[model samples]
Every structure is written in structure tokens, then in C-alpha cells.
Target: MSPQPVLLPRRHWLAGSGAALAAAALARTGPAAAAGETPAPGAAGATKPLPAYAAWKDPSSLIVHSSNTIETRRSAFGTGVITPFGQLYVRNNLPAPDASILAERDAWQISIEGVKNPRQLTLGELKRMGIETTAMVLQCSGNGRSYFPDKPGGTPWQVGAAGCVLWSGVPVRWVVDALGGVDPGMAYLTGTGGEKLPDGIDPKSVIVERSVPASAMADAMLAWEMNGVPIPLAHGGPLRLVVPGYTGVNSVKYVKRLAFTARESDARIMTHGYRLSPPGGKGDPSQPSVQEMSVKSWINGPGTDGTRLKAADVQIHGVAFGGMHAVAKVEVSLDAGKTWQLARLAGPDLGRFAWRQFVFAARLPAGQFTLASRATDAVGNVQPEQRMENAGGYNNTSWADHAVKVSVA
Candidate 1:
């Protein structure tokens, strides 16, 4: 995947650029077809394979939006709370660095500033300071953008652009303390990616640097591992910064510079990108940065592929999570949003930052039905009925748009 900016509308970006090839590939191989199941004869572009860089991923489990922006298939979720690395989504803001950098992962170094004793520390040294594991939702800011009526620019991702995964690394707090802590006035924790930049273009125009509230450091980490294994290059290997509960972008990949700053970074990505604005509005410095995700849930089973089911007991199940809070309960609706029933929360509670798998047992006769799930966090943040209209379609926690229709024979 090559580095590209998100400046054009979805149609223009997908149809006007080579990325169209990737989208075309997804169309020819629907979820079933990609999974090697029986498919209609002569599906368009069905013979194509995932980009060479991402060949390690299971094409059957993901929908390729572009070489750099692959998404998990809805059916590939498989009712599991911890998404396997093979099935996780990939959304890169810049092309990944050569994998050769990972030959000696422990030697990877990151510069830490705004501390009393600022210095560059290698991954090996940071790991020696302290290490912890955290389970959180890694969701793209535009996860449900396709549900937007205006169809914003960027990948028209669905719920599949998110997953709950475990991250292991040295807590940012530990690193700071080891380096004598941050300066008194630091207000933001900023991270800069290590991807190479275009030769003639100003670095600020394409660099991926984001700054989150300094308070987030309590839950942040400079992670070297994902799902218990050393992170893969496509998913930010060698080293990455993890900011739990925030949008995936905040967790900078190939992180090289991490600092406690007095102000947020002035990079274009921070000033003109990822901001929340009114529908059809242009991103500006006045807008808020897309950060913590909102509570969201979507039905994943009784397959939305319109498969006919025998009239009997059916298990309607899916996943739900409160962005930064623990989910208090999840309610399911069988007939769209008209009525709701409390669904059983299944599986061990991974953590507040992680999603919970929920299951609802329903008895049905031969017919059709719309299924939806609503989640409420411990703080009483209920999943909304409608997604707020926005310029970029960033955070869409709307239940109505994500509801699934099922055919029962």
C-alpha cells in the first residue's frame, strides 16, 4: 500500500484511483465467495488475491477496501471477544516501513521528550522498566462511515473496521517515571509515526502525528506486542503507541517520537484532519479531534446474507462495548427498534475497554425479521437510535443503521 491523503470524496477516491482495483476485488468475491464457499459462476475479478504486502492476512476473512485499508468481514467475527490477529482490520495512514527494521525488535528506539531527563530509549530498555497488558477496542474513526447518507470520503467501512485485541507493552506512565516524569505544564501526550515521507512534500502535510490529553497516559503504552506476539509490520510492528479507548488513529503505528507536549501537534493531520464538523463542512482547527469512541453494538449472526433458516430456536448474537466505560447491559430488538429485550451478556468480562459478546435466544417461525442491538455503558451512555450527521462520518454508533435483516424459511 502506498501513502495517500484523504482529500477526495469516497467515490472519487475509490473509482478515480488504483484503489478501485481493490474495491472491485471485494465486489467479485462476496463474503461467501471469498471464504471458498459455493459461489455463482464467473464472479467478477474473483481470481485476484490480496496485495502482496498483506498476503499474510486471510483474504477470505477480510474485505479489501485498498491495499492499506482492509476490513474484517462481518461473518468472520465468529462470536469471539478477542479477535485473532489474522482476522483483525488494517487501516494505515501511511505505507508501512520496510519489515527489515524488525530484524532486531528490541533495538528499536523511541525519543521521549518533555520529561526532566529526556532521552532515547530502546524497546529492550522500556520493557525492562515495566510491562502490562490491556484489552481494548481498536476501531477506525470512520468505522461506520458507509451508514452516512452523504457518504463521506475515505474508506466506507462498516462495523467490521473494529475489533477487541490485547496489547502488551510498557505503560507510558512507567516510561515517564523512569525518565523523571513530565514537565509541570505538559497537557498533551503526542506521538509521531516513523513512516518515510514524500521527498518534495513538506513532512507536516503527510506525517501521522497525533496528540491526546496527557491524562490518557494512565492508560497508554508504547506497545511492542499485539495478541501476545510481536506486532506484525502491517499492524505496527517493532513499536507502536497504544491509547486505549481512543480511535485507532491515536494509537500511532511505527511510533518513533512520544512526548508530553504543552499543546497538540500542529501537523496537518491534527489541525485539518479527523476533526468533527457539521455535514458538508470542511475540517478546521476549531473542530474537535475524533477521540474516544461511543458505545456501539451490531448483530453479527443469523447471517445477514438473507440465508433461509428453519423455524425454531435461533441464537441472535453480536458484540458490544462502551468506548471508555464498561458496558452495563445490552438490549436486543427483534422487530427493528419497536421493542427490546435484555440479552444475556456472554463470556468473561475482558475489561471496560474491551467489548463483550452478547447472545439472545429467540424462537421464530418461518418469516423475515430485523435484528438490532443497543448497548448502555456504566455511565448511562446508551447507543443512539440515529447517527449524527457529520462531514466525515467519523463515529457512527447508531443502532438503526447497523440493524440486520434476516430471512427465515
Candidate 2:
């Protein structure tokens, strides 16, 4: 069993102070810090203030990593399927465009290329083309970085940097069909963000452009609204690309360019970043790009604040999700995986990409116990016992690393 963490008052954890303390501890022990690797210039730390657009988030429900980076607290997820806007995490690759841009939201234009008749489409014009909505899990590429033993160079996120959300937009397929279809040789779909570029730097070096498999366009969309409202600027307003079953970065925020390419984008972000590298290795074009997420699940209720529970009936509940498939079932292990019991899957099945809530009830006597959850997807892919080691600590779906340790009195 994993060693117990130091216990703290519930109030501290709930107020977000203890969450900061936990993040600081993880940062100090990361492999980069241990090997004396210097932090990149201007790299944000755990103490930066939240950005103006994120001021509405509940401080008690998030761990602020930087002005543009914040994560939801696992406990704050509660039992809801649709994460409340105030509790959803915020992650921005570049500073969001000024809120003043919302003044002419309908007039925002997106250039479409690689089609028989390439043209620009205004947000208002696209809205008149077709409308569709989908619910999917929007997760960061390094969501489980803290669980990596080698420790990566990004935010030490755990299970909170992800959430299921509803996006409404014009389907990419419909747009392409109306525009006379994509070029015959196109093999990739690329989206470019609209954030203003910093001066004196090669725009390609820092632009947010990602090229995904052309097949993704089947479920891809140019989303103008999130959770039923005009997409908030903080989360990418005016327009954003929504790719279901893929990592959040692929859903370009403030998207301004949509194109079908014969090859992937040449942007540095596409050619050099978000790649899966060997342990202690540097990312490069040879490495695989972060795309679709994998099957994962973890306990959320009975928070891991080291609190003691009563020696009676206890209800254990959490969430499970399949990256591209539906979760078949969730199993609960109260004795650190020694014995398992099938848990009741609660709530409505939102779809294959949406998470399913799982609940289990158990009676216990005074003792120390560890709780864990295992999930299997429709294709027979089971959540693993351990995570694969990698330079960026990207995909982590291990049951052991995410298990909750608690005491029953």
C-alpha cells in the first residue's frame, strides 16, 4: 500500500490552502527539481494569481497554478455529471484575446482552406449552416503528471484537470460538404488559435496550431457555445474547435483557421510539443503526438484529506470514463485491491465519451483502509495497475496511484 499522507484539517483542504501546500510539495520533489534543472524563464509556479477571466471560479474549489492555469479540486467535482462552469478548470496556452472582442462576436471570421472553394466564414454565417451538440471529456495532456515517478516539467496535476462538458457548434463535415469538400490528397485537419502573437518571435514557434487525423472531422465542430452559453473568453470564446474523445489542446481555443492538410502543421507546437517521449528524454518530431485520451477512473467522494470516517456504513462513489468508448463497468476494491466488488453505475449514461458515476456501499469496523476503483471500457480495455513511465508524465490511468487512503474510527 502507498504510505499515508500527512493529515490536515478539513477546513484547510476545502478552502484551497491545503491544495496549494500539496502542489508545492509535489513541485519540490519532481525529477527536474531533484536533478537541479533550472525552470524555464517566466514559467509559472504554484503561487501566481488567477487571471481576470477566471475570477469567477470558486477559490475553494480550484488550485491556482498561474494567472492562466488553474485546476479543479477533485473533491469539488461533487456528484454532478456536467461540471459547473465555476468549478471547471482553466488552461490557456497563450493569454486569451481581450474580452472586448466579444462586442462583435457574430462578425468573427474563420479562414477555411484545402477545399475546392476555400473561403472565410463568419460566426453568424456558420451558425446558419448547421447546428449540433456533443458531450465529451475535456482533459489536459498532463493531467496526471503528479503520479509520474520521474516527474514531468509541467503542472503537477492529479485527477482534477478534466471534466465532461457540452459543446454546441457547426459540424466540420457539414461545413466541408457545403464548401465543395476537402482536397483529394488532404490527410489531416488543422486548427489555428487567434491569440495575438508576441513581438520579435517567430509566430510559428509559439502559435497554437494542431493537426489531427482527418477522420476526426467526423465528430469535430466549430463550437461557438459551451454548456449552453456563448463560450466564455477564458475558455475560448468567439470560436473554438471541439474534437470529441481527444485531448483538450486539440480543441483549439479562439480558433481562427480551419484547414485540411496533406501533412501535419509545421508549427513548433505540432512538430515538437505534446509528444510522448522516452523516460528522461526530450520531445521531438519522432515521438507520438498527444491525441485521444485513454480509459481512466478514480474515487472522488470521501475526499483524500486524511479524514477519519465513522465505523459504520459508508458510501463510496466516484467516476469512470472511456476515452473513445463507453465504460462497461466499474469495480471497487476496499482492501487495496485484495478483493473487489461490482459498483452500481449511477446517473444517466450521457454517451460514450461522458463519464459514468459509480457508487458502492460498505460496512466496516474500526481500522485503516485504502479505497481504489478499476474501470473497463466496452472494448475490454481495463484500467491498469500501474502507469507507463514517460518524459512528460502524460497518460496516467493507474488504479494504485490514484487510490484514496483513509482511516475508519
Candidate 3:
């Protein structure tokens, strides 16, 4: 993660460059893939609102997909170091805990069991272990989920179902180490959250339990704060497990129970949801679940589609990130990939899991043009020109992904 600047109050950061604010997210929609009753307490009318986001985002500009999820646009690389708490994207499998309960996180208990030394820790106890900060990108497993050719299944996410945040928490390793080390036989760290389904829905089926590989526990965090402030209910306040580099699903929210086990959790979420299909094949239940994200990048601006092409020189910038490696560099294509130019990467390396910001500049004579971008990670993975189509549109990293057009005056 990048070095954190001096901490400031929420209003200060909100009014400033938005670097110090804490956050809260989603995509657009069709027939509404998400089911179950509305989760937000005091939800206005038929639509559930994320109050934390309502504090910052212009409601008029948001794309409400389901009762809960919302999406943000790209137009950044020109703004804050961390996505403001109010502007961070949100996605929830279950309804959030009421504000009254979240306001008293210290009263909530996290049941940590199944390890050699099973125990319980309140939110206050976890916070007393000292503070560390990490700035990493947190993205929904289906951040790029847009129904192109397939029938829309879930939230219609664009690029906005993702955000970079500065999290404050205690390393999960510390907690595990305090418990006398992990058993070599343990293979998974399964977690369950507080969001439960409305009455009548089989509790077992709708539970948002997920189990991540135990290996992630090494760098994982039990975070309670965002951008240095107490996290809001909308952003998984009280506590959330954050696993960097992996998709957002690994970072479970409203964590109430966690268990170390010898195998993956059998919870429907882990057993049936978010699995990746064989290349070019529809999602097969027998296939393994997805973990690291594929390398990807896209142009953020120049026309309304991307910014309007101007007669004068235009500056272009966007974000690039995927999986474990930091972005090495981004390449820009103007003539439909017939040619390419390297764009300058900005700033020093943040964290390996943090997204790399990039920029390019040029003057184009009046005409209509197509602009596209691709990124290569330090690990040698290059954003492909075409991504294999997935039934769920989980990782939509295709060559034409985010390609934009503008007519120059």
C-alpha cells in the first residue's frame, strides 16, 4: 500500500482530495438478478439505500441494479489517492446490520473456533492489538459483469463495482499466531456474516458463508476501520475480513463467525456461487471456484463514451490492476491495435495488490477515432486482446473492453 498521508476528519477529506475519507458500492441492471427481501433498515419506498454512499455520491448519477448494489463511473485517475468512503462501491449477499448495532461494534463478538485454541474476541479486543494501514483495491468477483451476449444473471456491473481503500486493522496472522499457530492440516478459513434472509427463505441456502484458502490468512486482516475512521454500516463496519489481491468475495462483511477447517466450506456460496467455467464453456458446477483476478486495463477518458474528442491536445489516464502482481505498464492503441504507445505509470509502487494509475497525452487532428488500452503485470500476464466469454460475465477483460470513440472537431 502507498504511504498514508496525515490523517484527517471525514469532512476534511471529503472537502479535500478525498484521500482521508472512509468509504462504503454496485452495478446497473435488467430483471434484477439478486433475490430475497430488502436488507437495509428504514429503506425508503421499495428501493434499499446505502446511507454511507448517500452521504457522498450524487444519487442522480448512481446506477441502482438491485435493492442494494450501486455503481460508480470511471473518469478518475484525475482524483483522490483512496476512493472516498461515500464513493466506494458496495455489494452484499445479505442485508446489512442495523445502524444501532454497528454503532456498538465493541458489543459484538466474533466466534473464532475450529482451531486448536478456539476462542471469542470482541471488536474492542481486536482493535487493541495495534494499528496498521494498507491501501489495496477491493473488487467484487463480478465487477465487470455486463450482459453482452449472455442472459443477464446478476448485478449488471461495469468497472465501478471496485474501489481502492486505506484499511486500518490488525493482521489476521497476529490473531492466529496468538492462538498457538495454525495446524498444517487446515486448508480453509471459512467465515459467516450477520446478514440473514427474511423469514421463510431456507437459512442454509441464502447464507453468505464463504471459505477462502488458508494461505491467504498470512496477509489477511480483520479490518474495522476505513480511511482511519470507524467504518460505516454500509461498508461492513464493526468488522470485515480483507484479503488483498483476491476478488471482494474473499473479504467477507459483517463477520459474525469464523472457523478454521481442513477443507472448503460447504456453504452454498462457496459450493455453488462464483465458480469459473472452463474457457469458452458455460459455468460448470463441477469447475473450481475463481481466486486471483485476470490482468486487465481500460481507457478512462476522451469522449462522452470515454470524453469528447477536442481539436486541441488531450490528456488520457486510467487505472490498471489484477491478481497478485503490480501493474508494470499500460499500452495505448489508437489505430485499432495496428500500433501502440507506452503510457507513463504514475507514482512509486504502492502495494502489490494496489491498482497502478497511468497516463498518456497527445494531439490528434480533427477526425473520428477509436482508443483502447491494455496492461501487463510485473508477473508477465498481459491483458488479452479478447477474453473468453463467461456465462456470468465475472471477469470481462476483453480487447474491446472499455474501448472508446470520440469525434474530433
Which candidate number has the best lDDT?
1
Arranged by lDDT with the best first, the candidates are 1, 2, 3
Ranking by TM-score: 1, 2, 3
lDDT of 2 by residue, 1-409 (tens): 2112122233443365433432332232111111212222233554455678888666666667887778776666767666767778888889988898789999999999999999999999999997766667899988878878766788788787898776778889999999999999999999999999999999999999999999999878899977667888988998999888899999999999999999999999999889988988988999999998888999976735445678988789899988878888999999999999999999766678778889999886788888999999888899999997889888888999888777888
Ten residues in sequence with the least summed lDDT for candidate 1: 1-10
* Per-model lDDT: 0.82, 0.80, 0.68
Candidate 1 residues 215-331, lDDT tens each? 999888888977667888988989999998899999999999998999999999999899998988988889989998889999888755446678899899999988888888999
Give the poorly placed runs of model 2, Cα more than 4 Å off: 1-48
lDDT of 2: 0.80
Candidate 1 — which residues are off by over 4 angstroms?
A: 1-48
RMSD of 3: 7.0
Q: After superposition, how far is residue 299 of candidate 3 from its true place, in Å?
A: 1.7
Where does candidate 3 have its weakest 10-residue lDDT segment? 24-33
